[model samples]
Target: MAQLIRTPKQLGVVIRNAHARSGLTQQALADLVGTGQKTVSRIENGHDGTRMDTLFAIIAALDMDLQLGPRSKGGKDISEIF
Candidate 1:
């Protein structure tokens, strides 16, 4: 399934969910990405200052792929969930 992420909060939710699904703790994910647990916590909390490199590293550690494309007009809007 595909999800549309329009805000940092939404992105955080996705990352947190994916991390849960992967059965990895924030500390564990940090270990995999060679960062600190606090950094993972910040990213999962949607801290906007997160560096692109760290973001990519965390995503890769979670076995996730970041895709870019035109926003789908037919998919569920993230606002509905919040």
Candidate 2:
């Protein structure tokens, strides 16, 4: 499946879902990413104020990849969904 997440909130949703799909608890993923469970919870809840390194670590821990393309064609591209 493919999800085009534009905002941090949507990215959080995708991470949460991916974590769920991986059958790992927040703490487990946190361990894999060398972070705390609370931090993972914060990320999943759409509080995206964390550092970019942490974000990338979370994404990598979940076996996910990021793809960036040219900006959307319209004023607001809601096509960015998880």
The model with the greatest lDDT is: 1
Off by over 4 Å in 2: 75-82
* Candidate 2 local lDDT, 1-82, one digit each (tens): 6786777788889999999999999999999888899999998988968888888998998888988877655656456332
Whole-model lDDT values for every prediction: 0.87, 0.85
lDDT score of model 2? 0.85
| Residue-wise C-alpha lDDT for candidate 1, range 12-82, written one tens digit per residue | 98999999999999999999999999988888898788889999998998899999877556648656454
| Number of backbone collisions per candidate | 0, 0
lDDT, model 2, position 47: 90
Lowest-lDDT window of 10 residues in candidate 1?
73-82
Question: Could you tell me the TM-score of candidate 1?
Answer: 0.83
